[model samples]
Target: MIVLPWPPSVNTYWRTFRGRMLISAHGRDYRVRAVAAAVSAQRYGQAKVAVRIEAWVPDNRRRDVDNLLKAPLDALAHAGVYEDDSQIVELSIRRAGLDRANPRLEITVEGA
Candidate 1:
């Protein structure tokens, strides 16, 4: 498993650029951090894989878990964990309760 920082919400991940959308600063930073944290990860190449993400939120407030998938998946793709996010044949995310001092995601990728 690879431990990574919690990603920004999908709502904050993109910004309006004229009439187009672009990755916001927060999104870009998360991508960079994802790559850094995944340095020791084993690449999966083009193989189909299953990814399980365990999230520890800083608060007990409600949040949409699905909205957190894109950034980390994209970051993993960019980091060469697989050719693309499409290679993820299965994905799951769990709300692992609070961790105010160290809110994060623990990700596990396995061959499917």
Candidate 2:
């Protein structure tokens, strides 16, 4: 699976912010783990956030997982989680037997 550098605060934000998306996509039903890493700070009473995301998809539905990433990303962009031009730092996909012991789609995003 893609293991990203997720800070505690960012994890909380994602759990709340993407909770609906996760539920809508039946995330809990899938035997997969999705993670996000981000930098957040408050300055002058304004919050600034930057993020990176890692999504672990199952071997059976790599294509479906690819499609699934689009919506939440768009939603995050719309919500200003990161800049529109945020770049993807890395993407790696590895194949393994069907189980949580191994991951299929390992994606990492940076500058977002």
Candidate 3:
């Protein structure tokens, strides 16, 4: 399992410009992936996996969990948890709760 800081929304990590040469939301996504790779301890090459995302927020509020998934999935791919996010055949996401001191995202990947 790998735990990482909460990633920005997909809207923030993915952007498009009309015929522009920009990639990965101006490299912000790449930076997040780099961090995930730095923290990852294991890598899986071609196995079906299950992913669980526990998002800890600072307070009790309504936030879209789905919006927070893409970046981390991409990060796991970059971290070499699997060859690609497509290997994650099962997924679970939940709002873990408030963490006044250290609100962040926790990701767990297991062979399925």
Candidate 4:
């Protein structure tokens, strides 16, 4: 299981969500994370991959960290990071807390 740190710039969101919107907005992050994980997996491997999110926003300010990682994941899929059989690819996202902690994004390719 190899861990990779995502670039800070990728987490930048100029728009802020208010009220229930914050929770729904989480979808964005989820997409980003998925894309990042996919690409990372393709470059590295698919069978093994995980994503850890370290958010800086206050707990109250956001609903779920998974939402923040979505875009990157979609990007990976769009970039064709999956395998031919699509059986050796895997992506997962785990949320921790708002800190300087290094979120570990793991990607593993089977039979690589």
Q: Which structure among the candidates has the greatest TM-score?
A: 1
Candidate maximizing lDDT: 1
Q: What is the C-alpha lDDT of each candidate?
A: 0.92, 0.33, 0.74, 0.43
Better of 1 and 4 by lDDT: 1
Candidate 1: C-alpha lDDT: 0.92
Better of 2 and 4 by TM-score: 4
lDDT of 3: 0.74
The number of clashing residue pairs in model 4 is 31
- Model 4 Cα displacement at 12 (Å)? 12
In model 1, where do residues sit more than 4 Å from their true spots? none
Name the runs in model 2 displaced over 4 angstroms. Answer: 1-54, 59-65, 83-108
TM-score each candidate.
0.96, 0.29, 0.81, 0.32
Q: After superposition, how far is residue 86 of candidate 1 from its true place, in Å?
A: 0.5
**Clashing pairs in model 3?**
none
Q: After superposition, how far is residue 84 of candidate 4 from its true place, in Å?
A: 10
- Candidates arranged by lDDT, highest first: 1, 3, 4, 2
Residue 40 displacement (Å), model 3:
3.8
Could you tell me the C-alpha RMSD of candidate 2 in Å? 10.0
* TM-score, structure 3 vs. true: 0.81
* Tens-place lDDT digits, model 2, residues 35-93: 23212311111223333344444445444333444434433343334444233334333
